[model samples]
Target: MKVEMILKELEALGSERTKKSYLQQGAHEPLFGVATGAMKPIAKKVKGNQAVAEELYATGNYDAMYLAGMIADVKAMTEADFDRWMEGAYFYMISDFIVAVSLAETEFAMEVSDRWILDGRELYGSAGYSCYCWLLGNRKDEEFDQDKLSEMLDLVKKTIHTSEDRVKYAMNLFVVTIGVSYLPLHEKAVEVAHAIGMIEISDGKGKHNLPVASVEIQKAVQKDRLGFKRRNVRC
Candidate 1:
C-alpha cells in the first residue's frame, strides 16, 4: 500500500483511549494512536518494503514509525540507516522497541549496539542494551561470544545502579535475558542479577523499583523456559 493509504488506514484504526495511553507513555503529537497489534494486517501487506518504511518513519508519527519497524527490510538497512532512525527516537518506546528491535536483525547488530551502549547517552545506551536482549532472545548461543557476554555482565554489575533510568531498565533486562536465553552464561547472569538486585527508575511522576532480575529469571525458570529463543524479533 502507498504511504497515503497506509496513513489513512492508521487514522481510521486509531482510538482516543489508545492515544491518551501513548501520550502518557511519552509519545508526541501527530500520532494516530494505533496499537501495535492493530497494525499487523497492514504490516503483513507491506512486509519488507524499505522505501515505504522509510517514508512512514519520516512522518515522525509514533504509530507510523512503529509500523515502519514492522514492515522494514532489515537486511537492506545499513548502519547509517539505523543511525538515522536512532536520531529520530525521542523516547524508550521508539528507541528500545522500534530501532533496537530492527537493528537486532542485522549483521551489524553487535557492532552498532556496542557503539550505542558506549555512547554514554541515555536512549542510545538503552537501545544498545535492548538490542542485545532481542539478539539473545532470538539468536543461537553459538552466535554470541561467551567472553564478551561475560564482560557485559560484569559491566552491568559495576554500572547498572548508577546508570541512566532507561539504561538501568535495559541493563537489568539484559541480565535477565542472558539468564533465560543464553545457556553458557546462565549461572553468571544469575550471579550478576543477585548482585544488582532490584533497580529504581523514575517515570517523571515519581520513582518506583523495577522487578528484580534474579526474581524474573527464576520465574522464567519455573516455567521451564531456560534457553528459550524467539523465532522472530518483530511481531
Candidate 2:
C-alpha cells in the first residue's frame, strides 16, 4: 500500500488512551499511537519493502517510523541508511525498539552498533547497546566474537552506573542478554551484574530502581532458558 494509505490506516487504528500513554513515554506529536501488535497485519502485507519503509519513516509519525522498521529491507540498508534512521529516532522507544531491532537483522549490526556505543551520545549509545541485546538474543552464539563480547561486558561493568539513563537501561539489558543467551560469557555477565547491583534510573520523574540483571538471569536459569536464542529479531 502507499504511505498515505498506510498512515490513514494507522490513524484509524489509533486510540486516545494509547496516544496519552505514548506521549507520557517521551513520544512527540504526529503519531497515531498505534500499538506495535496492532501493526502486525499491515506489516505482513508489506513485508520487507525498503522504498516503502523509507517513505513511511520520512513521515516523522511515530507509528509510521515503527511500521518502517517492521517492513524495512535490512539487507538493502547501508550504514548511511541506518544512520539516517538513528537521526530520526527522537525517543528511546524508536531508538531501541525500532532502529536497534531493525539493525540487528543486518550484516552491519556489529560495526554500526560499536560506533554508536562509542559515540557517547544518549540515544546513539542506547541504540548501540540495545542492538547487541537483540543480536545476542536472536543470533547464534558462534556468530559473535567472544573477545569482543567479553570486552562489552567489561565496558558495561565499568560505565553503566555513570552512563546516560537510556544507555544504562540498554547496557543493563545487554548484561542480562549475555548472561542468558551467550553461554560463553554467562559467568562473566553474572559477575558484572552482581557488581553493578540495582541501578536507579530516571525518566524526568523521580529515580527508581531498574530490574536487577543478576536476578533476571537467575529467572531465566530456572526456566531452563539459558542459552536461549530467538527465532527472529523483528516481529
Candidate 3:
C-alpha cells in the first residue's frame, strides 16, 4: 500500500472520540485529529490483548510525546493527520500501515514508532523494543522456517500470557522470531549473527537504557544446548 493512502486513512480516525482522549494536555503537540471516543488506543494496549499489547508495548509514549525529539512537522501533521492513523487502528489495519511505512522513507518508521511509543508508555509498552526488533527482522541475517516461526510466535504468545511487563514479550518476539530462523547463533560469543535469528552486536539498548533484549535473546538461544529457539526447525 502507498504511504499516502495509509496516511490519509490515519487522518480520518483522528476525529473520533476515542482518539480525542489521547491528546496530551497543555502540550503544543501536533494534532492527529478530533480524537476518537469509540476506543482510545490505550484501551487496546491495556486490555491484555497480547496481539495488541505486544504491538503496543514496543512503543512507549512517543506518539503522545511527538514534540520531544524535534520530530513531526506539527503543521503538516495536524489534527487531521492524526485522525487517519486512529482510523486505521480501529479496523485492525495497523499492519497495513506498517507495510506502507516500511515502503516509505526509512526515517519515517522511527516517527510513527515514536508517536505510538508514547501511547504504549501510558499503556505500558516500549517503542524502542519494536524498533529494535524491526531493525533485526529487516536485516538479511538468515532465512526462517514456518514451523520455527510458528514456535517463536507461540513462545511470544506464551510470554505474553505470563509476563506482567509487556516489554519482555517485545524482547522475546525479536529473539524468538530470529531464533526460529536460519541464523548462525553462536554460543561462545556474547553476540552471534545468522544463527536463525541471532545478530552479532554488543550490549546496545535503543531506549529505556534497559539491557533486556540481549539478555532475553541469549536465554532463549541457550535454553536447549546452544540450539536455536525455533521449534522443530528444518535444517
Candidate 4:
C-alpha cells in the first residue's frame, strides 16, 4: 500500500545479481520461458527478513510477480492488499508466452497479445502472429486483411522480383488456403503470395490441397527475427 515500501523491496531484489549468476549464464537446466524459477532461489538468498519468497511467487512469473510487488508488499501482502494487480507491468517475462503461442493456443495467443499491449508494451510480435494464424487455422478464412489475400499475393510477387526477404516470408504463410471461400482482399494476398513464392498452381478444379512448406515458413520467420538486427529496421 505504500510506495516507499515497494521501492525498498524492489531495490533489494534487484541487488541480488550475484545470486542470479547461474540464471544469466543459463548453465542450469533451463525452464524456458520461466523467470519464477530464477526468482525463487534468488529470493531465498536475501539476507534481511524480507518475505521475498511471497512476492516472488505471488502471481506466477515476472509479469504477475511485478504486479504483486506493485500492488502489495509481497513480503507482507494480504488478501485485502489485492488492488488492481496490473499496474502497468514494470518488467516483462515473455518466453513462456512465446512457447504457448507455438502450440496454437488461440486463447493464450489472444490473451498474451492483449496483455502485451496493455501492460507490457508492443514486444509481442511473434505471439501476435501466432494468435492471427491460430484464428486463421488451415488458412481458409478470408477475413484477414479485409479478405484480400490476393492483394497480399501480388505484393509477394513483387517482393520476389526484388528478392525482399521480409515479404517472401510473410507471403508464404499468407497462402495455402483452398477452401471455397471468398476473401474480398484476395487480390492483396495474391500479390503477397507471389512475392514469397507461395504460388500453388492448382489443377483447375480447386480440389487440391493448399500446400504449405514448413521449411519455407521457418526461413521466413528466421529472416523476420534477424530483421530486428541493428542494421535493419524494426518490425
Candidate 5:
C-alpha cells in the first residue's frame, strides 16, 4: 500500500486511550496510537518498501515512524539514512526500539553502537546500548567479540551511575543482555551488575523501577535459558 493510504488507515485506527498510554511511555503528539498487533498486517503489506518507509518516517507521526521501522529494508538503508533516523528519534520507543533495532540489522551495527554510546545524548546513548544488547542477543557465540564486550562492561561499570537516566536504564538492560545471552561474559556481567547495584530512572510520569541485572540473569540461568539467541530483535 502507498504511504498516503497507510497514513489514512493509521488515523482511522487511532485511539485516545492508547495515546495516553503512549504518552506515559514518552511518545509525543501527531500520533495514531495504533497498537503493535494492529500495525503488523500493514507492515506485512508494505514489507520491503524502503521508499515508502522513508516517507512515513519523515512524517514524524509516532505511528508512522514506528511503521517505518517495521517496513524498512535495513540491509538497503545507507549509513546516512540510519543517522537521519537516529537524529529524528523523538523518544525512547523510537530511539531504543525502532532506530536501534534497524541499525542492528545493518553492517553498521558495531560502528554505530560505538559512536552512539560515546555521544552522551540520552536517546543516542540509549540507542547505542540497546543496539549492542540486540546484537549480543541475536548473534552467535562464534561471531561474538569478547574483548569489546568486556570493554563495554567496564565502561558501564565506570559511567552508568553518572549517565543520563534513560542511558542508565539501557545500560542496566545491556548488562542483563550480556549475562543472559553471552555465556562467556555471564560471570563478568553479574559482577558488574553487583558493583553497580540498583539503578533508578524516571520519565516524569511516575517513579521508574527498572530490573536488576544480576537478579534477572539469575532467573534466566534457573530457567536454563542462558546463551539462548533471539531469532530477531526488530519489532
Candidate 6:
C-alpha cells in the first residue's frame, strides 16, 4: 500500500464526469475524481499507515487527500498536523468532512473548533462548526459541557442568519446534530431551527438548498430516532 500505488489506483478509478461534478462542488485541479466507493478498498489496504496518509495529503491530490483522511490515525496526529491539514483543505469535503472528522477524534476538538469557527477564512470557519457538530454527535452527554453546548445553540440563534454562507450551513447542521443526538437540547434545537428558518447556498450554477432544521428534526422525531449517538464521525 505505497502512496504511489494507491495514487495509480485512484487514477484508474477516476472518471471525467465525476471530476466535473467535483469541480462544481468546489474541488480544484490535480484531482483524480475517484468516487468514494472506489476509495473504500484502497482505504482498507492502507488503513493505519500514518506515514502514508501524511505523504498522500502532502501531494495535494483531492483523491489522495481524501484517502489520507480515511487511513489517518487521528490519535497519532498532533495539533500541528491538524493545522497543516486545515491549511490544505480547499473544499468542503476536505475541510468539513475529512479534517473536521479527524479533529473530532482528538482531545483538542473543542479548543481547535472554537478557534476555527471565529476565523475569517470560510473553509476554516465551516470546518470549525463541522467539528463541533461531529463532537456533539459522537460524544456521550455526560462528556459534554452542557453550558457550552447551550451557548453554542444561542450563538447559532443569534448569528446564523448573518454568518458566512458555508459557515451558516455548518451552523445549521450543528443545530440538527444537537436536536437529533442530545435529548436535553432537542427542544431548544427545534426552537433554534424555527428561528433560523431557511438557509440557501449557491454552488456554481446550482442553488443548493440546505434542509430546514425544524423539519429535519421533526422527521427524526417521527422515526423515533432522536437522541441516538453515533459511535464515530469518520467513515
Which candidate achieves the best lDDT against the true structure? 1
Candidate 6 lDDT score at position 5: 87
TM-scores for all candidates: the values are: 0.98, 0.98, 0.27, 0.28, 0.97, 0.96
State each model's CA lDDT, in order: 0.96, 0.94, 0.35, 0.33, 0.90, 0.90
Minimal lDDT window, size 10, model 6: 200-209
lDDT of 1 at 34: 96
Could you give me the TM-score of model 6 versus the true structure?
0.96
Q: Where does candidate 4 stray beyond 4 Å?
A: 1-29, 32-123, 138-171, 175-188, 198-235
Candidate 5: minimum summed lDDT over ten consecutive residues — where?
Answer: 200-209
Model 3 lDDT per residue over 116-205, tens place: 534544112333335434543454444323454344344443443333334453544445445433245322122321122322222223
Q: Listing every candidate in turn, what is its Cα RMSD in Å to the true structure after a full C-alpha superposition?
A: 0.7, 0.8, 15.3, 15.5, 1.1, 1.3
Alpha-carbon runs more than 4 Å astray in model 2: none
The TM-score that candidate 4 achieves is 0.28
Q: Model 6, 143-228: lDDT tens per residue?
A: 88888889999998998877778898899999999999888888899999999899887766777779999999999999999888
1 versus 5: better lDDT goes to: 1
- The TM-score-based order of candidates, best leading, equals 1, 2, 5, 6, 4, 3
lDDT of 3: 0.35
* Steric clash count of candidate 4: 37
Q: How well is each residue in 162-194 modelled by candidate 2, as lDDT tens digits? A: 998999999999999999999999999999999
lDDT of 6: 0.90
